[model samples]
Target chain A: MTYDWTLWIVFILIGLATTLPRASFIVLGQRATLPEGLQKALRYAPAAALAAIVAPDVVLVGGALEVFNPKLAAAFAAVLATQLSRNPWLPFIVGMGVLWALR
Target chain B: MSPNFREGAREGFRVFLPLSVGLVPWALVTGMTMGGVGFTPLQAMGMNVIVFAGTAQLGTLPLIAAGLPVWLIVVTAFVLNLRFIIFSAALARGFHGVPRAERWLAGHLLTDGVFATCLEKMLSHEDPRWRLGYYLAPSLWSWLLWQVFAFCGVMAAGSIPKGWSLEFMATIALIVLLVPMARLRPMLLAAVTGGTLAVLLRGMPLRLGVIVAIVGGIAAGFAAERWQGKGR
Candidate 1:
């Protein structure tokens, strides 16, 4: 239960580093313009980041690929259910349910 | 058209509702794991409050556990959150009318969900005030819920089963969010390339694979868009 002062210092420093970038252009005001190429490319950031986060989880079983696992199967169903359903909860329920059932 | 406050609030709740299921599991894992990594409860709470980035926070756990240098932790958090800069750059044009203080607030609170929800609403509504309201409403919901559940996680550590694998719920939430954002060709290309490359590079240490996949997918999607433009 001992508090690490160094870790707390690191956390604050990291917090500042994280916040500066997010507000960079927005706080820079109306005239700020990023490079045209980079501006266009920023459109892909959300998709790319989310994909990077999800892909490893779906495929890696114990940090290695397990092809027939329920997690993988449920992921596919969840993706498809997301495409077809209006309700947001359905895909998550379907995915988690499948994972639980198969496990 | 000015955004109806009530309307924005309702939309905010709707978006935040399903995502709550995802946040609790992540918060639990983060809170539970932080204690095991030598972080005191107070320090974990401090990190949660100051460093609100989930993936970056989770990533920090492993680095801290390995007794990595603080410089490395700072750099890892920096690189992981570089995407926030992208989010800011993309949404800045829409937010020009917002005051500097609020924009700074937006910067501090921004995340994948906030970015996605705000950008989506901006695309459809085009009213900065409405956009701001919608974004703020949900952003507040997420931040508060994250703090509470993460605290619960810290207090209820080890009570959660090892096999529960609640991280999957977080992934499912991410997938659901990602799917809606991928309606366009370039967006779809970005996601698919990122995913495939992620699988290819999963073995890399410190999830460096994620960094590579992010850059690769963006480059791929941007190139595809350019190729389509040439065709047009």
Candidate 2:
């Protein structure tokens, strides 16, 4: 299928939006210090972002909190799988296995 | 090209190889999903080249698939990419002595993983050119491998089974990523706070809840770390 032509505009905007943030402090931080408070808070950005993305999908299934959702089951199982295998692919395989079985 | 570029890139690529193994699936899944949705292979590759952001790209996909407004998708991706700002800030000090053009190149190539790798190099030794080389080196491999595998996934999407729950695997991929980083109390707190709030605020329109959770979690962890006098 052909892409909606408008999607091209959206991509340019997204590309710009994403790139500027990655560039801003690189250019600016050379001249002035980022605010002290923000500098400290930025350290938490990774943990916060990852958690914010994962937690909702894991805990909330079917638009409500259901413990039995395949997602949640697979999520916990994946955690265990990572600890055992220490291989990144292991978790995904186990998680998908659990997801398919539970679903 | 600086004389150090080759050495730096080589070191960066070599060290990043293991992590790339983990990252390969993400790009593959993203490419496949783009095909599963309405995107043509060309469009998917175009987006891959343009976006160069796994998280933001993945985050925007669901919204797009749900038929959300384009503006909302853009905003979501921007908010998701905001973490790169922090990374840029951290990278800035290391890159300050470099040429502006080089800095721009590094900024385009920067990802959290590469940032971390380059930061480790900066910490171990204090050479501005070397640091830049290290940063750009791994980044090249990362960009190349990601695009190649993702393109393959897009081309092969139809052959792949639908019931494999690849998205859940993606989620699990993300979880494995999160676990190791959440080592400290502050980090753990941030993750827990963000995650809890996201689940609680799942109903917020246009997935603003994700933003709320991220900002809220960072604020919480920052406050906690400040209280403990352990902020770094």
Candidate 3:
């Protein structure tokens, strides 16, 4: 297949997309100030965004809710595993293990 | 570097070295997905070298493969990287008199774990040079480790068994990341709000649901915090 030059452009833009936001406050220095309330709210944005990404993946399958699915089960197992151990590898090991066993 | 600067850098690297364990799975997943989804190895690694944000890179893979509009993909990435905006803001608090160019470089090198480590270890250090040295070591180490493992994943993607169900692992990775952040009541509320909304609004075109879910989650969190304050 032929190269799509726009794909390269998209790649470069994605880089800027990450870099600009990260550098926003630093570049602006003290001139720009985030609202106090907004700053508190921003604390939750990352977790919420991550949950938003994950919920659709495990809670719904093929655009429909499947509460009893293996993926969901594995996710719960992963959470439990995380709580039980501080080992960084436990979640992945437990999670994928449960997913594989159930499937 | 001065003796103080070298000592600070050593302490920073030592503190962050243990946490680098968590970076392995994430980096590998990011790289494997990029290559597995049909990008050339060069393109995949190039994306790593440039975008440098694993979550956004992974989040956009499906959209990129689906041939979504360029602007939409870029917007999605910007939203995905919004957390970095907060990170930059919080971390820049101690950088008052640092040169503009150095601040810009520091912001660009920032990563999720490195930010937490820096805040915990060196944010209050009296010397600017020491703090600078402390921040740079871990950030650079994280960056280097990510690039190395991600490159391995990109090269190994072809050999990994197809039945491994790698995509699900990516989801699991995100779940792992989210669990520690959701310990507080307000955070849990935010996650539930964002997640439920994402599911309900999944049909919205162009994956706008993700953005709405994030906003909804943040609002829910803010409201919960306010309510808790009144009860105290």
Candidate 4:
């Protein structure tokens, strides 16, 4: 099949974005210090981003509120797993299994 | 393999082992979605191999599926993946004396999970060689696992029903991971501000709301830090 230049371009750019961040630090070397405020901000980035993604998924189902969705229940299970086990994969597995079973 | 490489690989595997099982479902979902979007298994696998970013991959897939302009899809992915630049720069400092090839390899292996683990170790002043091992081991495993599961998803795509609520599982997994990290005030504030902004601005085109949410969260975090510093 002929390659799509547009798709290839998009893929390359995506690759660059993903690789650059990890590579930039090496290129810039040790002189760069993440500013204090930035460091603080970084700390919150994961939580904020994750929450921004999760809240809607949990609270809204099928374009409306479905507080009692099985997804939420499974998510709750996953959260409990995370807290109790402190294992990232376990909660995800448990949650997914629940979701799969309910489906 | 050199001791350092072996050690790094070992540590990486140890860290990634548990997460490997969890990652299977997500990889499957992503692969299935990619296949459903008209990408062949080869293309999907190639993308996984090259990109290796979960959130960015997920974010960009719908656009690709919709046959949106490739530039838009790429730009969206780029913007979403920008945070990795900061992560990479932070990690680069520790790799000063490493060979150029080794640096490249490390760069390829760097992922959110590995970066987090490495950062924690770095903050604790762990030995650099050991830190490198710890960081590389798990991410490499994750990379391999992602590829395998993505392939499986591609293979099983037709068998899985649509609207399987798998998205919810993925979201829940993220929430499970995120809640603990949100313990601090700045993080909590950022989450609330970002989520609220995202909802309020959902009408914006091309997911501009996501950009707004991210910017707002970062700004809020910066402001919170400044306020805390002044109080101290």
Candidate 5:
């Protein structure tokens, strides 16, 4: 099949954005120290960002509130799995399974 | 293989194996979404191989489908991935002695799960090399699984049922992942504040409201941290 340049361009930009940060640290070595405020900001970034992404998707559906989505239920189950088994993969699988079954 | 290469590869494989399963559903959903948005299987797989970031990849698909300008798509992705800048800086401190090439390889493998796991390990371990291996193993697995399953999902596009509601699976996985991380008051506050803001601003165009909520959450978290007298 022929290549799609449009898609290729998008992919390349994404790869660059994803890789550059990691590579920069490697290149800069000991010279790198994030600003104190930035580091402080970074500490809470992931959990906050992740919650920002997931909360709406879980609690809202079809422009209405849906706190009890099968997905959320399964996610709760997965949380239980993680707590019980302390296994990362277990919760993901169980959560997905619960979602699939519920769907 | 050189000793370091062997070590890194072994570490990579070890982490890759267990993390692979969790990534499959994520990749599959991303691939299906790509297909739904008119991306050919080849394009979808290509995006997975190149981007390798599940959330950002999924986030961009809607923009592409909506025929938004390419530059906007690029900008949005850049903003979404700004968190990596912080992640990289934190990780950089641990790699002070490592050679450039090794550092480059590690950079590619860094991800949310890997960074979290590795940082925790680093706090407990003194040896940078050991920390590298411990972290790289799981992240490498996650990356490999993500790409492989993404390709599979693309190839199986038409055959995959539409009503599977993979979005819900994504939501569940995300929630499961977030719940554990929100142990601190700041983290819990960030989640609640961000979630509320996202809901309040849901009507905003181009998902800008979500972005606003994220920024708000970050600021709140920063304030909370300062109040608690924690961190630099």
Candidate 6:
């Protein structure tokens, strides 16, 4: 909160910590070629990573798994709407509507 | 620009425009969070511009507010953003022959949405120029929306209703994004593995659960693919 030199220094360090990993392979280029198997593994990593983030968000309530919660229900509705409509906005709209209504 | 590049850029912008709707709220929330934590307007916006990563920004804010040491906070961000290493590796194929400066710029602009969009749709395209154009359009669009909304959030953080739960939109947005990509059998298997592991490992310190879930999911997907190949 304090506008001080240490805070600013932390800001720069945080920026570097965040950006460098993203640029790692891009800058490494030919120097560090990924093995073919690693490349193959990378293909599935994104979906898995996304699911990893989302699942905890939807299912966890107060650090406990609450299966019957509105968030889970809303998530289910969103998945169904996304599959049926195949429109990007509909799932979000429907899911939020469900959450608001249930709450 | 060549016709191919222009076309790719146009397509990229159009596809990203609708999805950009989902980004605005998340960015605003990030800004509001920085403001709520007592950051000055300039500092909040500076953090947004400098870090350009919502998750890390939000994750570190509590630590900053609690007066934690700078090194620990930076290390936490490094661990939180480790997934980007995998993403850049996956995306390297598209930028194989790109100039060094340009690659650095592209890497800076990358976000979760942009990375997911590119990996799903554009990475397989044969033309590097076209892929670059496609990548840049969404990157720039997202950056613009994020900065502007985040600025507004910092300014108007007090007025926004606390109970609106507007941040829930981010979860809904992610769901919509993931559902389409999980249509494939192996991908679905990977998602299931990842989601289950994440829930099971939620108590892990430093959010290492995400990284572990991702690895488990990828291995599951790889095994599934090999099994299907053998069957065929």
Regions more than 4 Å wrong, model 5: A1-8, A64-103, B1-39, B58-83, B93-105, B112-143, B153-158, B230-232
- Off-target runs (Cα >4 Å) in candidate 3 are A1-5, B1-8, B62-72, B120-123
Better of 4 and 5 by DockQ: 5
lDDT by residue (B8-121, candidate 2, tens digit) is: 767777887787675687788777766666577888888899988887777666556556677767766776677788778766777757788877777887887787667767
lDDT of candidate 4 over B95-214, digit per residue (tens) = 765667767777866777777766755445345566566666787778888898888977776565555643344465456556676667777788778777766665578767756776
Candidate 6 DockQ vs. native = 0.48
10 residues in a row with least lDDT, candidate 6 chain A: A30-39
- Candidate 5 per-residue lDDT, tens place, B59-156, comes to 66655654556675676566557778877877677776667787888887677777765665445656667666666667767877787777776666
Top candidate when judged by TM-score against the true structure: 3
Global lDDT for candidate 3? 0.82
In the range A1-103, model 2's lDDT, one tens digit per residue, is 3457888887887888788888887877567556877767877876787787777677775678887777888888888887777665677677878888876
Note the residue pairs that clash in candidate 3.
none
- In order, the Cα lDDT scores of the candidates are 0.74, 0.76, 0.82, 0.67, 0.69, 0.79
Estimated TM-score for each candidate: 0.66, 0.83, 0.87, 0.71, 0.71, 0.67
CA displacement after TM-score superposition, residue A52 of candidate 3 (Å): 1.7
Task: Chain A only: give the TM-score of model 3.
Answer: 0.84
lDDT of 4 at A94: 86
Tens digit of lDDT per residue, candidate 5, span A1-103? 2235776887798788777865676568777667777767866666666676666666676668888777567767776886788555676578768878887
Ranking of all predicted structures according to DockQ, beginning with the best and ending with the worst: 2, 3, 6, 1, 5, 4
Q: Pairing residues by index, what is the TM-score of model 2? A: 0.83
Clashes of each: 0, 1, 0, 7, 4, 0
Per residue, candidate 1 scores C-alpha lDDT tens digits across B11-85 of 876876786566666676567666555565788799999988777777556556545567766765675566777
lDDT of 1 at A27: 78
Error of 6 at B34 (Å): 7.7
Cα-based lDDT at residue A49, candidate 2: 76
CAPRI band of model 4?
Answer: acceptable
Which has the better lDDT: candidate 1, or candidate 2?
A: 2
